[model samples]
Target: MPVRFVIGREKPGQVSEVAQLISQTLEQERRQRELLEQHYAQYDADDDETGEYATDEEDEDMGPVLPGGDMAIEVFDLPENDDMFSPSDVDTSKLAHKFKELQIKHAVTEAEIQKLKTKLQAAENEKVRWELEKTQLQQNIEENKERMMKLESYWIEAQTLCHTVNEHLKETQSQYQALEKKYNKAKKLIKDFQQKELDFIKRQEAERKKIEDLEKAHLAEVQGLQARIRDLEAEVFRLMKQNGSQVNNNNNIFERQTSFGEVSRGDPVENLDTKQVSCLDGLSQDFNEAVPETERLDSKALKTRAQLSVKNKRQRPSRTRLYDSISSTDGEDSLERKGSLEKEFKQGQEAERERSY
Candidate 1:
């Protein structure tokens, strides 16, 4: 018998659906083999039995025999196939060719399934690599956050340090300005002090020269007075010699002449008493009287001159003391140097006078 069947075919790309379809095809083939075996057993049963295939018009040679009359020529149709016996036998070579084509399609399907399995494994590996990358990126982000926080703290500390440094600089600048003012003031004071010292030195020099001149004049006056005193002494000595000779030669001469009345006022013997005449007049009589009056006057004048010379000598020591005080170079302050030179001069004069007396 010839049969026609309708089965849904699966697409090659869907590996699971293709596998399911192949399994269903194999089940259908097994059921077909069972059906064919049953049909063959039925064809070999006893010819005497008229089973469910018996019919009133069945041919004695092709179907079953019937009791005698001339057999009618009849044509019957199978309900499913009218040409089931038309070829009378099946060809084995054509069936084998169809089976070979089915095997080639199944082999191709198996190869396509294997290629898809390989593609799936590759895709899984790519997914794993992407996940690893994501984890590493997250770790890097955390590290960056920590670094940013530390940098902010350092920046704050640096700002505080900068502020302190700026304040210190301001304080230092003010101190420097104050120091500059003090230095300028000191410099001006030094200039004024130096000017005063120079003026003092000049005045001292002038005063010293004046004192020296005065001393020179005083020495000249003393020498002149000494020479006058020497001349007066010689005149007094000559007067004494003349009077001595006259007194010795004129012993009896006073009896002829008046004793005191004949004497002139210029003659020193005129005012003499008799006691004064007898006092061993070895020097000239004029000298004895002349010395009393003239020597007294000259002695008074000499004493006054000597006092003046002593005073001048006292001033000389003071001037020399002032020189000592001026030339001092100890590191004492300017105020010490400012002591009155005149005061020191006076002190020195007093000390010198004490020593001279």
Candidate 2:
């Protein structure tokens, strides 16, 4: 009845029990039919001898027979007997109906057994498919676990590298700050040294200008002293000429005074005559020598003065050459200007001498 039943063992057990029970019922019915056939043959023989047969209404009038009565018939329920029944005693129609029923029931039981076998095969196939699906799911779970382990290791390595890079960047920033401070200090020192050097050069230039001014003042004073000396020499020449004319007038007066004098009485006339002759000779000698000596002295003094003047003019060129050498050390422009001034003064003196001539 239930599909859960084992087909191989349970089907055979049920078919065997049903087949045994049907065989036992058919054997019992066969024995009872044989006994009834024997009794009917005996009654028919007796009735033929008496010239009479029993009718159906007469058998109905004799009713209510007991189990052990003399006229009891064993048709529906009879004891087991080994004797065979006549074919006439068996109801052929009823036997045929029961045999057909047994054949139909056997066909139905065989069809039900075939259906159970097909269902059991299908259930076994479904169990095999479920086992394969379980193995595939377990394999997938193992692969996922391996991948997760690899990802965790990579994340740890990346974190360590990031920490090291941050340390290096901090060191570089500190080095850059120190270098910037030193560069600023060196630049400031260079600027201060340049300022001090410029100030020293300016002071030297101012001192040089003062020395040039002092040299110019000393040259002016020397030129003024030379002009004064020339004026004094001209005055000395004029006084010498006036003294020579006064000496000539004094000689004439002295000769007139000597002519008007008288002789004394106690003296001899010959002595007087000798004295006058000697006096006239001495007076004549003084008049002749004094005038010429004065003239010669005046000419000699003028010649000596002219010679000294010429010598001083010649020496001035040598003095100017020495000044030129000294002035060259100071500057070339100052030396050139001094040379031009000396040339102008010499030209002016030459023009004054030509006007006097």
| Best candidate according to TM-score | 1
Provide the lDDT at 83 for model 1.
54
Q: Which stretches of candidate 2 lie over 4 Å from their true place?
A: 1-95, 154-357
TM-score of model number 1: 0.36
lDDT of 2 by residue, 122-219 (tens): 53454455557667777777777777777777777777877777787788778878878887887887788777768766754564344334434444
Per-prediction backbone clash count: 1, 1
Tens digit of lDDT per residue, candidate 1, span 4-37?
A: 3334564677654335545665665566546645
lDDT of each: 0.50, 0.48
Cα RMSD for predicted model 1: 26.9
